[model samples]
Target: METVRAAERALMARLPEGTLMQRAAAGLAAACADFLGRVYGSRVVLLVGSGDNGGDALYAGARLRRRGAGVTAVLLSPDRAHEGGLAALRRAGGAVIGPERALGAIERADLVVDGVVGIGGKGGLRPDAARLASAAERARAAIVAVDLPSGVDADTGEVSGAAVRADLTVTFGAYKPGLLIDPGREYAGTVRLVGIGLELPPDPVLQALQHEDVARLLPRPGAESDKYRRGVLGVAAGSARYPGAAVLAVSGALRGGAGAVRYVGPAGDAVIARFPETLVSDQGPDHAGRVQAWVVGPGAGDDAATVAKVLGADVPVLLDADGLRLADRDLVRGRTAPTLMTPHAGEAAALLGVRREEVEAARLTSVRELAATYRATVLLKGSTTLVADPGGGPVRVNSTGTGWLATAGSGDVLSGLAGSLLASHLSALDAGSVAAYLHGLAGRLASRGAPIAALDITEHLPDAWRDVVRD
Candidate 1:
C-alpha cells in the first residue's frame, strides 16, 4: 500500500488540486447511497479520523446530508479534521460530535462509514477508535470502510490489534494485496473497488484465479487420446494400516482428467478392491509401467523407501503428507524433474524451521521462501491455498475453498487430483493451482452447507470440472 500510495500521490500532484479527493469522495458517496437503499431519513454515522481518510468520510457525509439522510460525524481528532471537508459537511447540515457522543450515534446508525484510518495507518485502532468499532459491532449497523479496514497491514495482511470489521470495503484505484488475502480478507467482508484513475504496475505481487483462468488451463482429450496418451498418474500411497488412503487417492486421479492410474504400494489389494481399473504392482515405482507423473504420500505409513524411490523417478512428482515427512531434503533438492510440494501450515513450518503460527501469519513470505528453498513449486494449503513457482513471480491464490473443505483425507484427494493434472502435461504451478480450484469447488458442491466426508469431495470433482468447462 505504501508503494501504491506513493504512486497515487505522484499522480495526484500531476493532476489539479482536490481532483483526486473529489474523485474519491464521488465514488465513496455513490457507494454509501447504494448500500443505504433509501437514503432519505437514513441514519448515517461517519467515524472521522485525522487524515485524507477523514476528508473522504466528511465529504461523503456532506453528500448524504443533501440527500435527506441525517448525517453525523464522530470526530476522533477535532483539531486535525480536514478543513474543507469539515466546512462542507457543516454547510450541508451535518452534525459533528466528539468520541463521547460518538457511541450514541453509532448505536442508532443505520449505516457507518469507517474513515478512521486509510491504507497508510499501521498497527490497530486506538482506545477511542476501538471503542467506536466495538459499539458499531454491537449495533450491527452496515459499516462501509472508506479504503481499508483499520489496523490491517496493507502489504502483509497482518492484523496486530483491534481493527474494524466492515460489511463492505470501498477501495480506490486498484485492489490492495491485503483485501485479497485471508485474516485481512475475512475482516473486509465484501470488497467493492472504486477507481480514481491512478496508474499501477502491470503485474501484481499476488493473484486470485477466477473461473475463466481455470477454464483455459483444464486439460482436454484429442483424437489420439487413450489411457497412456492422455496421461498415466502413478499412486505410491497407502499401507497395510491405512489402505483407504490409496483408494481415495486413486478415486481422485480417475476423475482428474487422467486416462490411467497405476497403483504401486503395499495396499495393492485395497486399491484393486475399490478401483478394479487400477493397474496394481507391488514391485514399486520402477516396475509400475510408464507413468507420466507420480503422487507420493497421503497414507504411506512410515514407508520412507517408497517416497525415496518415487522422488528418484525422472517423472514429475507431488509430495504430500507422509511423503513430505519421509523424503530426504538433499535428494529432493537435487531432482532434475519438476517437483511440487503441498504442505499445510504445520508441514510448511517444519520445513522452514519456524512455528506454525509464524507460517500462518505470513503465508506469502513462507510459501515464497519454501519454493526457493526446494527449487520447486510450493502449494501452501490453508483457508486460501497458494501456489508459487521457484522463480519469485506473482503467486496464484485459490479463492474457491470453504471451511467445510478442511475435513480429513481432503489433502489426499488434492494430491491425487494435482498429480493427475501434472501427468496430463501442465506445468507444476498450473497443475497445483488448477487442482486447488477444482478441489475447492467440489468441496463446496458436496458440502452444500453441511459437513462432508472426503469421499464426497472425490465424487463431486466431475461436477466441479463440468461447471468450469461449461462456464
Candidate 2:
C-alpha cells in the first residue's frame, strides 16, 4: 500500500539504520526456535533473496547458528546478497550454499525460511526463486515466510503465477490485506503476528467481525413491541421449478429478527405448508401490502417482472442471484432506500463484464468497484465474505464459514437473513455484515465436518444467533 510504504519510510528515517531489521530478526528467530523445539543439532535452511527480507532471514539464521543449530543459507543471487548479513552468518558458523545445493539442503532441513520477497515485491516468483519454492513444497521441511508470503500482492491479494505455500508466516508490524483475503490467504497457510512497534493509522484496510460486535448489533423486541413495530420482511422468491427456494428463504426470515414474514410468489402453497405463520399472497411484491424491507431473487428463475416489481418499492431491498442479473443498473443507482447486492464470483463477473477468474483474483478490488458502481452496500460472497459500503471504509470480512457452505440455496438463506435485519432498521452496511457473520457461523455449526443442505443452514440460524447474543 502507498500509505503503508510512506509510513514505513518516515519511521525508518527517524530510527537508526538496521534497528528495525534487527527487531524483526529477533522475533523471527524466536518463532523458528519454537518450531524447532530443540535448536541444538537442528538443520535450518534459509532461501535468501536480495532485499531486507533476505537480510532478516540471514540474521535469524545467525541467531540459530549461535544456539548450536546447523544453518545453511541458499543464495538465489550471490552477487546481490546482503554483505553485512553474509559476514555475520559466517562469523556465527553459518554456511552459504548455491542454488544447485538448495534442493538437497532443503530436503534434509528441519525448517525452511522463505526470504525470497518482501511486501513491496509484485507479480509472482521469478524462475530461480520459483525453483526453490517448488523444492520447498516437495520437501518435508516446515516452511516459514518472512514478512508476507513470496509473490502475493500485499495490497490486493492477487496471485498470478508461482508462489510459495507457507505453512506459517511471521509478519512484522501489521497484516497485509492479502493475508486476510482468499487466493493469497490460502497460500499463506497460518499467520503469526510479530509486532515490532510501528504505529499504523487507526482505520485499517479491512475489519473482521467478533462475537461481541455481533451481539451489540442484534435487534431485541421491547415489551410493547407489536409485529409491525418488531419489523416485517417481504420475500419474492421461488417458482414452480424452484419452490424450495421460497421455502428456504422464508425459513431463514422466520428465525431472523423480523417479527412477520410475507411471502409473495408462485410458491405460496410450499411456503404455507412449511411455514403457516407466513402471510401468503398470489399478487406480486407491489401488492404484498406494507413491509419494512424486501428480499428479491434467489431461485426466482427468469421472473424479471417480479424482480422489477420488488425493485420499484420504497422499502429497503436486498438483491441476490436472479435479482442481481435482472435489475436495471440505472434504477439501482437511483433508489431512495438502501440497497444491498450479494453476488458470488460468477455473478459479480457478469455484472462487471469480466472473467470469473479475474474477479476471484482481485476480490477486494472487485467488491469495492461494485459498491462504487452501484452506489449501495455490496456483499461479495466467497472463501471470505466481504461487505463494502459505498464510501470505501474498512471492508468487513466474515471470519466464519466452512468450505462445506458452498452448496445450493445458501445465497437464498443469506438474502432472507440480511433482508430481515434491514427490516429491523439497521443501516444497510451493518445489516449485511452482521447477517454474513451469523450465516457463516450457522454453516460452520451445521456442517462441522460433513456436508449440509441449505435448509440445514437455515435451521441452525437460531443456534448461531443465540451463540452470539448469549452472555
Candidate 3:
C-alpha cells in the first residue's frame, strides 16, 4: 500500500536550502508538459497562494516559461507571495496578475495549476479564494492541483470548506489521505505522486492496493483438499422480514471456494430455495453441526436471540450489518478465534462511538482504531475500502469498484465471502481485503451500466476470482 505521511523525517535531516522545492517544481513541470500539447504558444495559468506550495508552482511556471509556454500566475494574495519564486518566474518571462486579471486569463488558458494551498492549510478555501476556485472549476481548461486540491485536509480525507475540483493532482513525496478518500478524493480526481528526495517511514495511514500484494495474500486451493477438509462456512444471516439477504449471502458463500455452506437461520428455507446445494438447517448455531467459520448479521434485524445464537459459535466469525449493531466490543475482544468486521461508514461510526462524518474523514485511522479497540480485523467500506488488523500491519485500500456498488445487500455478500475465506485459513486481514477486492470487482462486472441486485453481485464472484488469479 502507498501511504502519504504528515512529514518525512529523512527530508528534514538535511535542510538543503531549495532542494525539495526544486524537485517539486521539476516534477510539476514534467507532469504539466504532458497536458500542454504545444507549450510554445499554449497559455498556462497558475493559481498562486502564500506558502511553499505557491513557490513550487511559481518555480514550475519559470520552467514552463523557459520552454516557451505563456505562463500567468494568479496571485491570491500579492502581499504574501513567495518572493524568491516570484522573482524567478518574472525573470523567465512569467506574468503575475491579481484576481481581476486572473479571471480573463483563466478563461482562455489551456492548463491551470492550483498552487493555492499545500498540506498545511485549514478549513477549505476562504471567501475570496472560494470564488476563484469555483470560477476555475467552471473553466473548460484542464486543471491540475499542486500537492492536493487546495482546500482538502492532507492528514484526514475531509473537506471542511469549498475546494478546487481538479482534473489531476500531483502530490509531493508521498500520498496524503485526501487523495484516496471521498469528498476530498472526488475533488482530487486522479493522483500522481512525485518522490521529492524524502525517504518516509512506514505510514501510520494507508491507501490503495497493488496487484503483487493482493496476489501474495489471496488464498488458493492446494492438493488433497476436500469439501469438509477445505472448510465449511456457517451463515447465520437474514430474517423472515428480509430473506433476500440470506440468498445473497449464500450466493457469495457458494462461489467463495468453501467446502460447503451451512445455512442456520430463520431464512434457511429461502437460501435452500435459491441454492439447493446449501445444507439447510432450521437449527441455531449450537445445533447446526460443525463449520470452520460463521458469517453473522446482514438482514438479521434487531433480534437479540438470533444474534446470540450466532455469537455462540466456536469458529472464527465475520460480523457485518445487524451483527455490527448487536456486537459487544468486550465480547469480540474476548474471542479466542479471529474475528473480522465489515462495516460501512455509518456502521463503523456506531461501533466506534463517533459520528458518520468523522469515520468517513479519517477512514484509515478509524478502521485501525476499530481493529485495536475490538481486537479484530476491520474492513471499512466506501470508495476506498480500508482493511486493518489489530496487531498492526499495512492497512490496504481496495481501489476497485464504482459508486454503483451502493446497491442494497452488497455488503452481505462481502461478509459471507470474507467469512468463507477466513474459514479456509487465510489470516483475518488478508481474508477481509481479498474478499473486498473480489466483491468490488464482482459488483463492477455485474453492474456494467445499471444497478445490479445483491444476489447478482454474488453470482459474479467466480468470474472476478478468475480475473485476479489469471495473468
Whole-model lDDT values for every prediction: 0.91, 0.91, 0.84
**Which residue pairs does candidate 3 place in steric collision?**
4-175
lDDT of 1 by residue, 42-72 (tens): 9999999999999999998999999999999
Segments in model 3 whose C-alpha atoms lie over 4 Å from true places: 1-17, 353-355, 391-393
Q: Give the poorly placed runs of model 1, Cα more than 4 Å off.
A: none
Q: Please list the residue runs of candidate 2 whose C-alpha ends up more than 4 Å from where it truly belongs after superposition.
A: 13-16
* Worst 10-residue lDDT window, candidate 2: 1-10
Residue-pair clashes per candidate, as listed? 0, 0, 1
* Per-residue lDDT over 169-225 for candidate 2, one digit per residue giving the tens place of the 0 to 100 score: 999888888888988899888888887768788888888879999999999999999
28 Cα displacement, candidate 1 (Å): 2.3
Q: What is the TM-score of each candidate against the true structure?
A: 0.95, 0.95, 0.91
Q: What is the lDDT of candidate 3?
A: 0.84
Q: What is the lDDT of residue 190 in candidate 3?
A: 84
Could you give me the TM-score of model 3 versus the true structure? 0.91
Model 2 residue 220 distance off true place after TM-score fit, in angstroms? 2.4
